[model samples]
Structures are given as structure tokens and as C-alpha cells.
Target: MQKTNNLGSIKRLQREYAAFLKSPPPDMTIYLIESSVYECHFSFKGPSETDFAEGIYHGKFIFPYDYPKNPPEVYFFTPNGRFAINTKICLSITSFHPETWTPVWSISSMLEAIRAFMLTPAAGAVGGLESHSDVKKEFAKKSQYYTCPVCGANHQELKKIFLLENDKKNLTENIEHQLKINTSSTEVTSKLSNYDKTEYKLENVEKDHKIIIEKENNNNQQQDIIKEENDIITQNEINNECKEELLTKIENDEINKETKEKEEEINQEDDVLTILKKRQEAEKEKIKHFLENKEEIKEETERNEKYTVINETINIIFYLSIFLIILMVLNLLKIKIIMYFLN
Candidate 1:
């Protein structure tokens, strides 16, 4: 029966995953642990306007055999200090509140909720850890550089790309705005100009031998207008170039400073394979310890049962011996009374 449940769970997971792949949530990355379909690693961008802002937290989703019927357990692998590292965290979507769980809720929805939940006050749960708000903020700042060996990437890389794209976007917007302003100025200047924009028909002077002179005059006026337009366009180009140069320099300096910090953080990241090995060994050890404890408790229970039986036996024997002695004394007293009466 349990095996059947597991098969159903795997099928459900695959279907849900396909749906997620169609239109994945922004900034939330979840991937399967191929060895264990029930296990999935996830990373998400922290909610803004919170202590966890600008942070990327890595964790896992552990599902049960009866899942979709039951919510998955959520664990945080990264040390945000807001959540205990490698501990099962409590959330509405986790097994902590199974009574409220519903099959209608999907993994994507649950993860979205968990990200938002990070900003709220922590419940005093046994598995979770607590830290000062300032400490959490510090962790948040450092989270960007954290690398996941399994994913082979870090938040810093994403940030770097975003920075470059953002710079280009700003440059484009600025140029567009400046172009609009220039166009408006050109319109206003042309409107208020003393020169008339009236078009002269060359056909009207075709019959006259003075047609050649009129055409030359018209050509000279067109050249002057073209020259003025070229000057405005050249000036706009120069301004854009100067603005881009200054922006690039400032952005480059900031990236350089952060580059050193990211280097140091690179050393802190654990190789996923090594982490898996250690985690497996740790889990085995814990299971062994738990089994040993179970055996000890069973032995203790058996000993207590024997002790209770022995005590009961000893009490019964002692009472029977006392009852016999009382009966013997009473018979002796009866015999004495009978002898005294006969006398």
C-alpha cells in the first residue's frame, strides 16, 4: 500500500513540474534531485522591504509518499540566521500544519508563500533558529555571493548581468528623453522663426529665363537648413557619449569593490557532492542513534515489567504467611478458652 502511494506521488510531482516549466515564477528556481524525485532544491529572491532583501536563499522541498494529500517539508540549507540551517522550517505549506493542508495547493504556490513568510516574525518552533534583525540584514548582504556547487552559479553573477542590462536600459531611456526634448525645441524654434516656410512652385517660373537663378537660391536655402539640423544631431550624440562614459566608470568601480567580497565567499560554498555524502552519513548516524535509543527504551520497559511482577509476587507471599500465623494464634486461643470452661 505504501509503495502504491509513492508511485502516485512521483507521478503527481512530474505533472506539477511540467506545469511549472511552462511559465516559471520569476526569481524562484526549483530543480529535482534525480536520485530522489521527492527531493527538490530551491533558491529564491528575498522579498523586498524586509531584512532579507537582496538575498538569495537556497533550500529544499521534501515530499511525502502521500503528497498532494500532504504538504512537503521545507528545509533551509543556507544560513540566513532567520531560519536554522538544515532544519525543517514551519510554514502553512509545510507538514507543521497538516490539518490545514489541501491538495489544491501546488509546490509553486507553497514556495511563493514561504518566500513572503521569511519577512514575518518567526514562530518559536523547535526546528527554527532566531537572530537579531541587524544580523539577518548582514546575512542578507552576504547571501548574494553564495555559490551553490550543484547549480554552479551564484547570485553575484545574476547581479552582474542585471547591472549591465540596467545600465543599457537607462542609457536608452535618457537618449530617448533627450531626443524628445530636442524635437520639441526644434518645433518651437521653427514656429517662432522670422523665415517663411512657404513653398515656391518652380513651374510658375518655367516660362522665364530666370528659372535657373530661382533654383540656385532654393538649393542654397535647403543646404543651410540641413547644416543646422546636422549640428543639433551632433550635439545630442556628444552629450549621450559623455553621460555613458561617466555612468560606466561609476558602475565599474562598484563592481570591482564587490568582486573581492565574492571571491572570499566562493571559498565558503560547499561542493554539492561532498555535502550530499556528509548529509547521508549524518542521517545514517542519527538513525543508528535513534534505533539504539529505541532498544534501550524497550529493554528498560521489559525490566520495569519484571520488577513490577516480582514485587507483586513477594507481597502475595508475605500476606499469606501472615494470614497463616494469625489463624494458628486464634486456634490456640480457642483451645485455651475451651480448657478453661471445662475446668
Candidate 2:
């Protein structure tokens, strides 16, 4: 369950890991954590002709849940001679504003950006040191330190794993020839470019020996890169497996939540139907009682009407008999009074 909750974060980390693994930068190296893609460590060699030449530095990268959409956080484990200690550099891709980050840029590009931007003198920026050019050149000459706080090894020892020496003479000759050709085209002024070239070649006797040494060093470095790449791949596989497991768990949790919601909806529907059925039965019983009472009331009203008609007829007959008796008595009294008057 805990793993499932971290699915999105895991997936995001995996994507970044895959990208870094598939297309690694020549100047920078990375290794994944044992069980997590989101957290990995990286080591970067300073670019040539810079103050950090021959200097090695290490840093950590941490991705958030909404990565790509949001940039990750990057911090140096070792202090850069110019930058502040453990300061977060504001990168276009990994900054608070993601809209400014370009899709074309990759981890290599980010590293390049760091190299380019670290020399700026921005006040609010972290890790910017102001040193003289001569001082910087001196530091660059002897920058190899044996102890790495982050990787726990000397830069040369660590780099020994990926060293590859191509042909040094061929490489230097190619560079010198290109410089001569470029110089000739820029200006036709005095044959100064040709003169300088001849003078350099004559004065430099130990050139061949230096070339051999450089060639050997390059070969060693290339070999180290290959070995480190292999190690990174191995670690990335472990990270991917762990991430897959986490995503699967999350999917299951989502399914369970949906199922619970559906069951609750069904239960509510059942309750509503039950209430409606009860209401219908109660309505039916009330109608039945109303019909029975209406019929009984109608019967009582008919019986009362019949009794009232009979009482009215008996009263009328008794009154008519009393009036006939009074008439007969009055006629007899009148006849007696007239006879007494005549006598």
C-alpha cells in the first residue's frame, strides 16, 4: 500500500533516470540509488579552458512528484571554488519557472548551463566567487584532490574506471593544423601565422612525449566512462523494478476506491426503493378505510329520512280529529239557546 501511494513519483523518477542512462553527457557522470530513481548522485568534470579545469565536483539531484512539469532540485556535495557551499543553482529547466526550460535541453545541457552560468556575478546567485585570472589558472593546474567527500575517492582513481586514450599525436596534429588553416584565412598580412607555426614546432622538442602521455591519459579516461556507464545501467534496472512495483500498487488502490464508491451508490438506491414501496402500501390502506366509512354513512342517512316522514304524517291526523269534536259541541249549544228565547 505504501508503495502504491508513490507510483507517480516513481514513474517520474524512472523517466529521468532512463533519459540520463540512454544519453549520458561526456563531461558528467551519474549513478542511481539502489531502490530509487528519484534520488541519484552525479559527478562532473570541469570543462577545459575554464577555472575548473582538471577539477572534479560532485552533486545530488532530487526530483519532485510533478517533474518535467516542475523542475528538480540540484545541489553540490562539494564546494565549487567559485560557488557557495551546498547552494541550489537556478537552472532554466530546474528552476521555479518551468516555462523557461527548453525541451531540447537534457542533463548534459544542464551541466553545460551550469558551467556557463557559474562564472556570472549575480548578487542573489549562490556560489559565485571572484578570483583573479592568474589565481584561477594556478588552481586549475593542480586541482586534482585525492579525497572526494561525495564519492570517497580521488578524482583520478574514480576516473580510472572510464579512461579511453585515442591517438594523442593525431589529435594534437589535427588541432594544430586546424588552427594554422583558420589563421591563414582570417588575414593575409605578414606571413606571421606561418612563422609562428614553424617556430612552435622547432622550439617544442618534448611535444611528442607529451602527446603520448596525453593519449594514454585519454584512453584511461574513456575506459573509466565505459565502466561507469555499465554500473549506472545496472543500478537503473533495480530502480525501474522498484518503481514498477510501486505503480502497480497505486493502480490497485485506485480500483478499490472506485469499487467502494459504486457499492455505496447501489446501497443508497436500494434504500430509496424500500421507502417508496412502504409509502405506496400505506396509501393503499388509507383508501380502503375511506371507502368503507363512506358506504356506512350513506346507509345511516337513508334510515333517518324514512323515520322523519312517518312522524310528520301521524301528527297531522291527530290535529284534524280534535277540530271535528269542537265543531259538534258548538252547534248543539247554539240550538238550545234559541229555543229558550222563543218560549
Stretches off by above 4 angstroms in model 1 are 1-5, 150-153, 160-343
* lDDT values for all models: 0.70, 0.63
Q: Of the candidates shown, which would achieve the greatest lDDT relative to the real structure?
A: 1
Name model 2 segments beyond 4 Å from true.
1-9, 102-104, 133-143, 146-154, 161-343
Cα lDDT of model 1 overall? Answer: 0.70
lDDT of 1 at 45: 77
Model 1: per-residue Cα lDDT over 139-228, one tens digit each: 888888878676354678655533444454555575567567656745755675354322222332353345345446645654654565
**Minimal lDDT window, size 10, model 2:** 161-170
- Give the top-scoring candidate (TM-score): 1
